[model samples]
Target: MAAAPTRIRAAVVGTGAIVSGSHLPALRALADRVDLVAAVDVDEERLAAFRALAAEPDETGPGFTVTGYTDLAAMLDAERPDLVLIGTPPSLHRDQTVAALRAGAWVLCEKPLCLTLAEYDEIAAAENPDGGPYASVVFQHRYGSGAVHARDLLTGGALGAPLVAHCQTTWYRDTDYYAVPWRGRWDSEGGGPSMGHGIHQMDLLLHLLGDWTEIRGMAGRLVHDVESEDVSTALVRFANGAMATVVNSVLSPDEVSRIRVDCADATVELTHLYGHTNDDWVYTPAPHTREAADRVAHWRTPAADLPSSHAAQLSVLLDAMRDGVRPPGSGPDARRTLEFIAALYKSAFTGRPVHAGEIAPGDPYYEAMHGGHPDWAPAAATAATSATAATSAKEQ
Candidate 1:
């Protein structure tokens, strides 16, 4: 008998609008490497619509088959997917990811992995000991070509000892954007610009510059009538002695996301428009020797048809799944990022600076800050309560 073909069985949870816009499309792009067997969502209607969309004839290229499920547990029990994509909101990420991991499935969870550091710690501790079915957080910007190039420069010692790092994400979010009941809520989405929007840039900053030692942050509800901050700024101290200033806001008229790193030898800067397409990345290295200047000049020519960060990360993740190895941007990687967010929130609330190692498992605020009753929109609250009651009755 012929040996069985190797296939990376995959499933996606949370068929929210983003699942279609980001995760599904990326999965479609990696169709051959992955078998997208199941999609799970709480909303049956949304799941049905997504199934239709997934089944739609691909005018662009070949299509793969996918099944839909309204129950996550049912999908996991039936499909036994090799990899699971958790695209749920930040608040639900901890529970969903833990459930999937415990159910013997690898997970690629969306960002802001958890709402609080303690929750992040709990999820991180649940990883399989044998390293089968690992989990990764989706910090896609770290996979971008420009970011790759920057990392090469930094790692190659071309820019010696990064002295200063700066990141800015200024994207516009109108009233209509926040019209969604859970859009700007602290309990539901975790936080506003910092956790939801700025996290990508912050991840990139930390990934390149190394871990941060201390952070002092301030957040404010400048524009939106939400419980969380609409604008946030943080001063970060990296373990390598590099310092960084990060600013995130949802009030800007035009979208601009960019980063600049000043090193002992030279300065490297990257500027790109929001949504991360259109060959918009600009990398400028400070002039050093004539040879270095010429090299920088050579790199300045425009390149075409670069993969989106999401696509790049997805490809890497699929390869890792197939190889049964830990992928880049692994769950631990995302957990560290969430730890920073938790520290930032602590700093914001307490009006003090927070250190990375300070958020230990035994900390009083760790578990108390998250879990228990959720802070959500009235409609969501009612629905959640009803669902909880129904589940209790079913279990009884």
Candidate 2:
């Protein structure tokens, strides 16, 4: 008889909305496979609340009690968990992720992994190459049943060649939303809507479309008084000759997150705001091409409705941990999404198109999303706003 897989000892950092809403629920559901060891948050009250949500003693067997800490270092030392979930702000991600990887714990962090590619590299460099611990960013949409079936169709050329596409994440983020200290800052939250809000749709687009060749775009602070662009638009050209227009915005009252890929023989699309099931996807074959229509119509899809969410992606990550394999969205797979955003910002700031592999080791954009100096670019007015905010705080 086969032996049972060892349960993972898990510690979660940040007891904020994402943790309480998604991470905790998923962890509790898998109580048998995960041991909740510790939770860390700056807010003691929030940490206490998260600790209460830990599974009852019967959930994970007897004598199970979760520890709460207001400091990360103390928790890492005392708990020594195998998996760490980082739901902290963007600025904290680099240091926290690096610390976890160095301590031989695997990590699945919230998105916009860090403020810059350099910091991204730092986290990647800290991973265990001899193959014990690793880190994965959260891009859950890439793992759903609809996405898998769509990839099978495109990769097999059933939809012919992918020619063009459109991806949009138009949502609303008002002044009240950015009232939080970290919301709109480059150093903390990363780029505004593109980094925080629309990253889900954008990452899904990259997953389906594959490698990009060149991209150019612009960012605007239009409506919100935040320190980052509330809206960003870009034109992207893929390595496979596919072109796409991408937009990430928080100014739309009628929020919709959508992606459409037009192939030589058919068009495939997905539309959903926060999460999506296979029902949100649609495929349309060219009217004149009978073979193409039949091929798409007969394409097989998963029997399950597997939707996009933290839970869905965590399932895949857990499997990797159990099997001693690198988790999905790890290293370069996750880095590509962040790289795309950097290239878009570089283009927007430089007033010229930027290509993949353009921002290398020494490139200022590679070091920071706002470049080495935010004020160097006119589009990055947030630098001035941040400075003004800091000044006002000092005066007060």
Candidate 3:
């Protein structure tokens, strides 16, 4: 019999809701393949709560008895885990990732990996020169069975050349949602829905559509009283001559996450709020000929129904770790998505279309997403400034 694969030792860096709800569950599901040894958080109370929560029994067996730590460096030195799952805020991602990589641990980080292109470069610089300790972002939407099928079809020319596409991530977040200190700030959460919420769909769109050449975008503080834009929209031109429109908003009541691709032979769409299964996707063939219509049957034939979840991506990452190879959603692939985001923000703030490779070293946007523009100030700050000025004028 072939030797059993070595189970990797994994550690999680945060005990917040995302970690408890997604990362911990994923580790439990893959328990046979991973040993979660430690968890870290700044808050002692939250850390204790997380330990209690992890102690709960489940089908995967008795809960993962993980040691909790307040300092990440201490956890790294003590645990020396093979894999680190980062579920912390966007601001802390660069430093945490670099620390993990230097300690010879592969990282699977949550979305909006870092605040800017420069920060991304810093994290990337920390990886092993070969490939063993590479860091990958968690873009789960690309792992679903439907997405895999669509990628094969679209890239293999089965769906014909993709000409146009639409990607939307519209969800509602009221004042209470932004009550968290880091929620609405550009420095912490990155750039609103375009970076935080819509990024999942945006990454998936880029995954299917290939490289983007240029972006023309607009953003506004439409509704919510926050520093970042409540809504953003962009027109993207791809290297393959495909054009796409992207909309990211946190102001919509009827929440939906959607992506549609119009190819020469068919139209492919996947619609779901947070996660998607095979059932959420539909492929419609152009009725130009009987043979073209007949191909729809093959497209509808279901593969293994793997839903897009943290586990799905983790499974792939685990395989890569075992093989000692770099995985998808890492290195240049991740940078592409990050660069596109920076381009969108630059275009939105500067009122000019931004191109790929335009925001390189020394570029203001390379160091920060807002590019140091006064126009990009948060609405809350701007409002307060105006109020103060009005009161001073009346007193004078």
Residues 118-190 of candidate 1 have per-residue lDDT tens digits of 7776776777645556678888887766667667777777667789989899888999989888778757787
lDDT of candidate model 1 versus the reference: 0.74
Better of 1 and 3 by TM-score: 3
Task: Put the candidates in TM-score order, highest first.
Answer: 3, 2, 1
Sum up the clashes in candidate 1.
Answer: 0
What is the per-residue lDDT of model 3 for residues 30-120, given as tens digits with 9 covering 90 to 100? 8889988899999999999999988786764458788999999999999899999999998899899999999989999998878889999
lDDT rank order: 3, 2, 1
Clashing pairs in 1: none
Model 1 misplacement above 4 A: 1-5, 59-61, 275-279, 297-305, 362-365, 368-396
Measure candidate 1: CA RMSD.
6.7
Return the top candidate by lDDT: 3
Which pairs clash in the backbone of model 2? none
Candidate 2 on 108-143: residue-level lDDT in tens? 899877888899888888987656588998888888
TM-score result, candidate 3? 0.93
lDDT of 1 at 331: 61
- Candidate that scores best on TM-score: 3
TM-scores for the candidates: 0.85, 0.90, 0.93
Candidate 3 colliding pairs = 227-378
lDDT of every model, 2 decimals: 0.74, 0.82, 0.89
